[model samples]
Target: MQKLLASCIFFMLLAFGSCTQESDTPILVSTEDLLFVGGDKVRISGRLLTNQDVLATDHGFLFSTESSFAGAQTLSLGQKNGPGRFIGESTGFKIGQTYFAKAFAEINGQRIEGDVVELKTLTPSVSSFTPTYASAGNEMVIQGKNFPQGTKVFFGTQEAQVLQNLFESKLTIRIPVAAGQVVVPVKLVIQDKEIVLPQPFEYQAGKYTKVSEFPAQARIYDNTFFTNSSGFHVGLGRLRLSDSYRSFQRFDPTNGTWTEINFPGNPRRFAFASSSYLGGGALEVDRDVFQFDRSFYKINGSSFERLPDLPFNTREAMAVDWNGKLFLFGGRDGAGSVVREYDAIGRTWSQKRPAPFDMSGTTAVFKYGERIYVLAASGQVWEYLPSQDSWLTRGTYPGNTGQGFPFAQVIGKKAYLGLYRRTQEIWELDLETGVWKSKNQIIGLPQSINAGHFQSNGMIYILRSAEESTNGVLPMELYKFEPDAI
Candidate 1:
């Protein structure tokens, strides 16, 4: 009985030992986890399980677009001698696509594979872009996710230069030249997928043409400018402290020519001149001492009819014509905020309400509707109601005033202001809504000052003179501004 019992126990122990030996796999592979996933690449972590050190001729991962592993791509890890965790990476995968992956190992010419795992590549998308408005050659950045290699950007039909792409995201590109269009849609093409950005990009749309050189060949500064039925006229400014240019020149937009016109009144500098009236200036200079001129006149088609001389004298005063009356505001010589009115019927000058701040001929003032909008050097936009003779702060000027002396020309209901001394910036102000928008900067001569400006038929004509520091280096030029042009 004892022998029979011992035989049964021995058989049972042998069976248990056989089961343990069969359970010890020589080389086993497991698809542990996906370490990372990207637009076109993925890193997979895999494990090789074995009871003892087993030589694996090859170990790696398999990736394929099909679940059946047909036409699968292999990421071989060469060879392995021990059982442990292994990692492999596969690239050149399609973005926003689903793929199947599995870990595998080869031992003794036999193949071992783990369970297949499914993953989807990240989709490429754009979030936003900076600087909706830019000029050609300006750098702009696009923020997004999963921007694959060989991504293309376009501004309308023009292809932009790609500067840099970071982390398969965030693209920096150079703005392309505008193809005679002010605003254009921005688009991106990635891997045959086209994307149009929500907001369209605007190109700097100002075209500057040197219409003609100043025929006077003399740099004019602090001059008087006016426009009438005939044309635009500019004159009456000092070439130096003791020398002044009294020659008035007329520019005809119809023929694109300039003609020197005659003024019967004595020549003077720092005078106030509007459409039909001219008065008050510093005239004769004796050893650098100025004598103010108070003679007034009414201009009528190349002829001047003398009117009553001004009651007081001031230099560089702002003048405008409204309701058949000549209105002047501010000047040098302690007349900073004074407002004076001369009625054509009465032929007499009367003092009106004072301006809100100091104003001069250099201050940018334009007539829109029934109000005179004054742009102060301090970036304040003052609205003056000519009817009520009252003033109110409308809004703030956004552009740089620089050394002051910016020009304001109104065409229709829009006012174009800027080109302040030593600055090339120009801004457009909506007289009706009081909203300001930045326009394209002037083409050249940033260190230039405005000599005179007048508008005709929705186009603004400007005369540019060099600043004092840049005198003689930059020629006095006439520019025709198509405010709404591309």
Candidate 2:
């Protein structure tokens, strides 16, 4: 009986010691509140409560989108030799998402998880937007989420007028007139936090205003008009049956008068002319048939001097002056789609890449900044980079392609296109944004299809051409277009 009593006492003491050892294990005690919650990050804090005898290999916070700890993301505060308080942090959390977190500890090859804490992240994002190009007083809608009340919007440095119907997901603001043509960031300030959009917004720069009429000249079509450093020149087109003009005229904007000059060349038709002295003289004897001018010329003083011939003969070709060289685009040499570059400095001709599509008919070529743009008869717009020798199809022309002849001239990053069919409604294209807007119309302008057009300074000069009249009598008129006059 004494032996039995001794064994029972020993077993009870062993059991009590085991209970004490298990109770001394590390425990996770979380703080009542989170440290911080903003942006896409969160800060959590907690304490590991235990005696100095227990070891905590690792202590941190476990977070997850779900309430359970399975597949939760772990953020380690660090290893602790004994019980102590710890602060943990995590980033890259999704905006506007709710998350659950708990303090965790690894003790003696076993995991101990603390009580769960709910956390919701603050997310601000813009899903989609519209009206990348807008004039002042135009309403623009920005679609997003988490926009606080009393949010402020700005285009560049100009503050836009926010409308009354502003909501958390949608904002309506009027564009400010002070906006410039430059590509600028759109800023949205919500709750003292500023968010800038990835894509930039552009302000329309140009508007049309009718100026003085062109001094009297033979109303003719299919003529070549070019602008040089000296002044504007107009010449060479069908005046009547079996008759074409061999005379060239110079017009000084200051004097506003056309002075006839001697031009030595055969009566050419559908010839291309550039801003400088280089001009293409037609070699085709017949206008109705497919006859292209393989030869080109340069105007020296009052005379036309012939230059080296092109690789292929083409008529109605589009050409532009880029960096002291002439870039010739598609025209008709049996449906010509060829592109050639003529370097006046080297006096050599080399072929570049062809147009994206055939430019057989009347094509308008203009230069905006460093890039050369071509508007084909098919209403396709293309931009050419001279340095890279590359071509990019910007977009299709949003106007009537069937109109007699399309006119385009670039003024300060804006291309003014006009003379569409019989309508004098001019359209302005934001070259930076590729957005088109209709401007003021040119009233009292004739319905002539083929007018000679050129741009100098801020003025666009249109030389009136003879219409398809039964008696072959056309008015000789010229008009000047000013963009900012309005």
Candidate 3:
């Protein structure tokens, strides 16, 4: 019985040893994972396993377009010692194409391969483009990943000029011509596949129509303009030195014509005016001789009803109306820092808090909602709460406030500002957010100065006069500006 048991144990041990020999390998290679994939490159992670320490004569990876490893390209790592994890990288692959890869190890004289892995190179993609609004020849940047060579970009049907491509990612391009369209879609084509950008690109949109020339054929400077349901009125300014014009005219949009309106006041210049009130300008007593006019008046239809003269001899003051009261800010001739309030209902004037800076004819002021904004010469925008009679710095103006005299016209929630004297640049300010965006420069003489600006029916009308040093007679052209028109 003992001898038979021994013989059985020996047979069992022999069988076990044979099974182990059939299953075990000296050096086993496995394709573990794909580290990374790019438009033309890939990184492969692999591992070598062994029951005992072993040396491989050569090891690395094999890549092929076929799954059967036919006509494969070899990436030989030469030799490796022991069993562990290894990584290999390869490039020069076609983008958006599928390829097969596997890890390999040469043991003794025989080559062994791991499991095959399927990899597809990434295609080009677009995440975003900057300067949502741009004009022809403007530089725009596109940000994304896996951008391959020979990638084409299009703005609508027009192809944009690609300036630079950095690291197969960011693309800098020059905007194409507008192609007579205001807004266009951006598209990218890579490897015969097209991708439309998420957001449509808008060409700089602003339409300026020459409505008419100043009716008098003379440029008015230091003028006061106001708008009401009656019409757009212009009065109280000098057509030339010492020759102030008291000829108030109204431009009727319905008739598209200008007609004379009666204003019972002395010939004045540098007056403060608003939709509701007009007052406090310098009266031209003689040639180049002036005296501060303390006269004040309230508008009723096409005429002005006289009111008691202002206590202060204010001229060129920034006047705005809010909550049925007129708030007069710093004036160049009178107190340059005092804030005066007038109640139209009570027919009384009272003094309020002082302004932060000196005000003049060129100070840009506008009202939106319950607040009033003043653009200072320093490019800083200050806000004033009429109810609280307090002031706070809002933000900085981005455009050049060249020589001040920047004019603003509010339509809805947006205020279009920045036609600073001699500059054609215009910017749109969102009164709700205090954010600003640039619009197309006015298509007019940059040497001209903005004499007055007013809005009607969501459209802005700009009056530009020639500079004092201009040689030819430049007409005070009236331009109808459509801020959002293409």
- Tens-digit per-residue lDDT, 303-418, candidate 3: 89999888878878988878888989887745777888998887889998888887777678888888998887667888889889899998988998888888888899998888
After superposition, candidate 3 runs with Cα above 4 Å error: 1-94, 100-119, 126-129, 179-185, 198-202, 284-289
Weakest lDDT window of 10 consecutive positions for candidate 1: 1-10
Ordered list by TM-score, greatest first: 1, 3, 2
lDDT of 1 by residue, 360-393 (tens): 8658778877888888877788998988989999
Per-residue lDDT of candidate 2, residues 94-175 (tens digit): 6577999888788877877666878898867788777886556788888887665567898888898888534467888888
Which is the leading candidate under TM-score? 1
lDDT of 1 at 375: 86
Per-prediction TM-score to the true structure, in the order listed = 0.88, 0.55, 0.76
Clashes of each: 0, 5, 0
Point out the worst 10-residue segment of candidate 3 by lDDT.
1-10
Clashing pairs in 1: none
Off by over 4 Å in 2: 1-217, 277-287, 290-294, 300-303, 470-474
Q: In angstroms, how far off is 8's CA in candidate 2?
A: 81
Selected candidate, larger TM-score, 2 vs 3: 3
> What lDDT does candidate 2 reach at residue 203?
58
